[model samples]
Target: MSRPHVATIKEMAKFHTDSRYLEHLHKISQDGDNDDPQSGDFGLGYDCPVVEGIYDYATAVGGATLTAPQCLLDKRGEVAIDWSGGWHHPYHPVVGTGDLCGTGLGKGTSLWMTQGWVKVNLWMTQGWLGVDPMAGDPMCSFNMTPVRRAQCLQHALCHVLSCCVSVLSFHPVSLCWSY
Candidate 1:
């Protein structure tokens, strides 16, 4: 809605998706040939056809998925929503499923958490333990590290964004807030 923030090629590459695959998709979308028998390629024929804006379409969809979380992280909104997201499938990473970069979300969140961005309620903190009481919870019992908890939260947030209207409040480090 806000002029549509789009993720650049480099940003998407952080997910470790094969860059060549992305490039090929772009090429096929343009005047380049997708079904080149000379190279023994059969990727873009049916099911995944080589349309006019294939590359832009993929990046736009992927962009929506990435941007919503960013809005929350930037403190721009308590909850960010991307209706187009929830289920992402990029064939370059894997066949059919396209979720090899699934680890990308966790990796990104963990990085932010280390920088004191994401909230770590399940982790064993020096002071406030947040919602999860240190009574008999598995997160505290195992003494999970902040990074691990951040990674777990990262995965959970992915589902949360996709799920219909779930309210979760994550606080930045030092600046605490209600959940």
Candidate 2:
């Protein structure tokens, strides 16, 4: 029997922040460690709201569920999503630093998915956080992925990092795969 279609959604949440979500910001400051002016150590844990919100949106749009470590692939059609696939510097919540610092995890994963077969549309933030586009060794987002044949198209939208750069790219199901 043929395997069922699967999709993945991944987001590189920002670090050096006071709190995870805006709602808890005030609460975190109230009783937690506000020592660091840059980023307070609020000993509280909250769900990554953006990531959760994206999952909800994907489900509503007909995307399949995915595990944190699993990769979603579409050999037939298109997928939809809100944010994810940016692959910047991030702590694994516990382990070593995750794909952050602009290492091109998005491109890496895309290459793994298409196995070098499809094209990629890269959507990035603007201004201080904006990607040089013309810079970066790979240059092309699609080419950044493991899939050599993958082509990349840059989509530098307004207010990208302000929300989630992943949101700019409309791909249902966060693709997760082994590096």
Query: For model 1, how does the per-residue alpha-carbon lDDT over 1-179 read when each residue is reduced to its tens digit?
Result: 33346778897786645677667766766755655552235355554456677678768866876766666556665455554453243434322133432333322222232433255332111111231322233334554444554455455445332221111112321122211
Per-model TM-score, in order, reads 0.44, 0.23
Tens-digit lDDT track of model 2 for 1-179: 12323332222123323234333443334545333343323322232222324323433322221221122132221222223333322334422234332233232331332332234443321111212232233334432342221122122222122212122222211211111
**Against the true structure, whose lDDT is highest?**
1
lDDT of 1 at 92: 44
Runs off by more than 4 Å, candidate 2: 1-77, 83-89, 93-150, 153-179
lDDT score, candidate 2, position 174: 20
Which runs in model 1 stand beyond 4 Å of their true positions? 32-47, 90-179
